[model samples]
Target: MRIFVPGDAAAIALGADDVAQAIQNAAARRGLPVEIVRNGSRGMVWLEPLVEAETPAGRIAYGPVEPAAVSGLFEAGFFEGGAHPLRIGRPEDHPFLKRQTRLAFARCGITDPLSLDDYRAHGGLKGLERALAIGPAATVEEVVNSGLRGRGGAGFPTGIKWRTVAETKAQQKYIVCNADEGDSGTFADRMMMEGDPFCLIEGMAIAGIATGATKGYIYIRSEYPHAVAAMREAVRRARKAGFLGERLPGSTHSFDMEVRVGAGAYVCGEETALLDSLEGKRGQVRAKPPLPAHVGLFGKPTVINNVISLASVPFILAEGGAAYRDFGMGRSRGTMPIQLAGNIKHGGLFETAFGITLGELVDDIGGGTASGRPVKAVQVGGPLGAYFPRALFGTPFDYEAFAAADGLIGHGGIVVFDDTVNMLEQARFAFEFCAFESCGKCTPCRIGSKRGAETIDKIRGGIDPGANLALVQELCETMKFGSLCALGGFTPYPVLSAIRHFPEDFGTAAHLAAAE
Candidate 1:
């Protein structure tokens, strides 16, 4: 009998370890022979510590399980797929899980991340195999044809980025995976690394071939100890398996990668800042024109991509470009693993096509507020993402649609807030977050953030509320235009949106008063 429990951080926090131990004890006491595997979470976090029993029917899920319920579960013959009060039926059949397209996250919950055999058995290296069979030029062309874009906030075409590095003349080029997922309510990168590490490994390797980069580095944050540990072990296993090191078997091309940890600096999530940190320098954003593609990582041409962007390459290669490209609508292209968190009933990872509306995601898939109160607003993208009111619920999840509405689908983190949430406080928090995380590389972000927060405070305190609101808006405009990176540039999205959409939270219209 095979029984599975997640070993990922979220599951661990929910007492999965205790549950696993209890399951083991119960099985031992019952003289039942069972194989226990610690897999990654299915991304259904609210139903965490999700235990699965493999039977003739399929993997039967029972979640939010406690140690105390282990004996009861065992007695109920859950291992045999018997009825249980905690049974969630098939996790895949759940409404939240059914709607997703799940390209990058295909193997996330299905395989043991560290087991090379499990990875291979579940169609893991097919993309790399196909890429190797077709060669680098074809692989690059396939990526370009797939219409894939960076899953990292920028949404730049991944193929074009790779083409730039490929065409660049350089003695030493690099493939850098930005795994420093610093955005609040976002865990797609962490989940990918900790779940199906080999998928990322294969994707990076394919990137190495396509871009002519010989070395690769995954820049993950230090806060994710589990992910870091998993990636390190995965690298070792990959090297031993001939998936990495000197040169891949049957090919003259060579590529190797290493894990580099950042000091939990939010700024390091930025591509330029990440490169600086990777090179053992103080993490800071670099100026454009000499983009990372041309001058990056020790003054060499580099192909920097977010984990999901790189991970998506394998699928494009394996299934043909058009197959993956067909999933999304319009210019968005392919599936996005959207992470739902904060005040939502069914918070987890939902990877779907780009055409879904905000109302559908928040109300349908998310099941509204966890408190059962009316949902007031949703912060799409991340802390820097704009607050979308109920009136804008019809806005589609596509990149162009969001951009047209002055929004950004940054890393696909959607944070929900109930009616009780104060939009003014959220707006102020955006500036405060920027002030705390800014690298202090530019004057606009460094000083503007503090000024924005202080101004918002004055409005909240009812001291010249109208005038102070105007000052905050002015300060936001300066930061948006003058900041060196998205940190400062995007902080205004949340602030301005809050003031525009929730005027009641700010107590009277400051702009109206200014006109008077």
Candidate 2:
């Protein structure tokens, strides 16, 4: 018998390791031979530590298991698929997993990430195979038809970006995967890299094929130790199997890929800053217009993309563009990997098509706040994303929808906050975070951010509260309009969202003192 459980960081934190050990011990006591594999999550994170016992029917699943239940699980012929409390019947039947529109995560929890054969069996390398079968132009056209967009914050069209890079004439073009995920609630990159590494590899390889880029690099952050390890091992496996290194699968195209680790720096998540970090320089933002697509990575044309964008390529290629196009609503085509975190009762990754309402996710899927109180506000995207109260819960999860709500779908990380939370403190923290993380390339972001925090303090102190509020808004606008990169421009989203949604929280302690 074979059993697989997630080895993702989130799964580990939730005691996946212990669950795996319990399965081993249970099998030992039952005298049933079992080989346990630590695969990645199926991305239905609510069912985490999700244990699967392979049977003739299918992989019988159980999850959120506690170690104490090992003996009972074994005694009940768990290996033979007996009724278990943790059983969700068919894992596919669950509403959270069933409703999700998985594209980038198509192969995530399903295949053994390290196994090239497993990857190939399940529509893996189909994109690259098809790309090599046809020409680069056809591949680019397919991507365009697929309507895939960057699953990163911007939601830029993937096909257009590839075409831009392909059109650029440069001797040294590069494919850079921006795995520098500094966002608090986002972990899709981390999970994808660790769980389904080959998807990213194949995605980058396809990007190389489409754009005529001979080299690829995944700029992973140091915080994801397990991902880094998994990627290194996957690279080794891919190279050994001829999926990477010089001539790929006997094609004329020759591409190479490597992983570079960045020290703890939030600014490097920016494309230019990432380029700077790659060059072993201090991470800082750069002026666009000679955008990275035109002049990037050591002064060469580069395709800088997020993990999910790159990971989604294989699906688009194997499944065809029009198929993916059918999944999304409006301009936002294809499935989105939405991440849930923070104060929600069920915090995990939820990949779905781009039309579900925030209220549906928070109230129905998330099961409300963990504290059992009414949710006051939810922060979609990252810390820099805006706060949307229950009033805006009906808003769709599309990029345009989020942008219209004065929020972003940044990495699709949604962090929930209950009524007990104070929005003012959260707003101030956003400003403070911006001040701390500003790359210092532009003045407004560097200096005005500090002023934003101090100005918030003044409002908190009740000294000229009305004037101070106005000044804070003014400062935020200046930072938003005048800042160099997203680090500064996005800071205002959180600050302004707080003031707009929860005006009472920013009230000074002095106001309370006076009232009492």
Candidate 3:
């Protein structure tokens, strides 16, 4: 009998380790021969420790399983696709899993992350093979035609960035995978890294090949130790397997990569700052004129892409760019691994086409708020993302659509909030977060965030409510335009959006005063 248990951090946090051990113990007690394979999460975090038992039909899912329930599961004939309360049948049949496109995440949770053979069996290295066959220039063209964009906040075209790097005349070009995923309620990067490390590896390898770069680096945040470990092992395995190192399989072009952990600075999530941190310098945003593509990582040409952006390349390459582009709505082509977090009941990673409405994501897919109350607001991006009220829930998940709604799809993290949430506090928290995480490189971000928090405090205290609110707005405008990096520039999104959408929570005095 084959039993699958998630080795994903979220699952482990929810006591998956204990559940795995319990399964082992229960199998021992029953004297049944069982093979326990620690696979990546299926992204159904709510049903974590989502144990899967392989039967004649397929992998039957039993979820949110506790250690104590192992005996009960065994007694109920779980190994043979049991009739237990925790049994969730086949995972792919679940409503949440059924709705997703699962292109990039197809192999995640279904295979042993460290097994190269498993990765190959699930259509892994096919992209690299295709890239090798088509050659670097064609590979670059494929990405360009895919209409892929940077999944890390900024919606810059991925193909354009790659084309820039590919066209650049450089002695030593580089590919940097920005895995420093510090966005609030965002774990898609971590999930991809931990679940399917090879996908990221394949993506980076393709990037290196396309851009004529011989070296690549995955700048993962220090917070994600599991991701770090998984990636390091995957790299080693890939290197040994000839997928990496001096030359990729069936190709003369050479590409190798290493995993580098960041110092846990949220500002480093910015590309320039990440490049700086990777260069052994303090994390600080660099002014854009000569962008990272031209001058980056030791002053050479570089292709800096988000985890999802690069990971999507494998699929784009394997199936052709047009195949990948056919999934989503206009401009925002291809699927996104949207993470549902905070007060949502069915919180997990939902990978789907870009045209899904905010209401469909929050109410229909997320199953509303976990508090059993009406959702008051949903923050679509990171902490710096806008606080969208129920009225704006009609907005589509597309980048341009969110931008039109005065929001962003930053890392595709949607944090839901119930009616009890105070928008004032949420707004204040955004300021506080920016203040704390600011790199202190620019005056607008370093000082404006602090002042913004104080001004919100003043409004909360009912002190010169009208003037203070106006001042706060003015400060936000300054930060929005003047800040060096997104750490400061995007900070205004939540504050201004909260004030615009939920004026009542900012204090009745401020609301009435603004009315006058």
Which number leads on TM-score?
3
Quote the lDDT for 393 in model 2.
95
Tell me the tens digit of each residue's lDDT in model 3 across 1-516: 999999999999999999999989889988999999889999989999899999998999998898989999999998899799999999889999998999999999999999999999999999999999999899999999999999998989998999999899989999999999998889999999999999999999999999999999999999999999999999999999899998677779999999999987999999999999999999989999789999999999999999999999999999999999999998999999999999999999999999999999999998999989999999989898999988988899999999998899999999999999999998899889998999998998999999999999999898988889999999999999999988899999999999988889987765775576
- Which residue pairs clash within candidate 2? 101-352, 146-321
lDDT of 3: 0.93
Would you list the rank order by TM-score, best first? 3, 1, 2
The Cα local distance difference test for each model comes to 0.92, 0.86, 0.93
Which pairs of residues collide in candidate 1?
A: none
Model 2: lDDT to the true structure: 0.86
* TM-score against truth, every candidate: 0.98, 0.96, 0.99
Model 2 earns a TM-score of 0.96
Q: Model 2, range 376-468, lDDT digits (tens) per residue?
A: 999999978999989999999888988988999898999998888888788889988987888888998888888888988888777888778
- TM-score winner between candidates 1 and 2: 1
Residue-pair clashes, model 2: 2
lDDT (Cα, 0-100) at 138 in candidate 2: 94
Residue pairs with clashing backbones, model 3: none
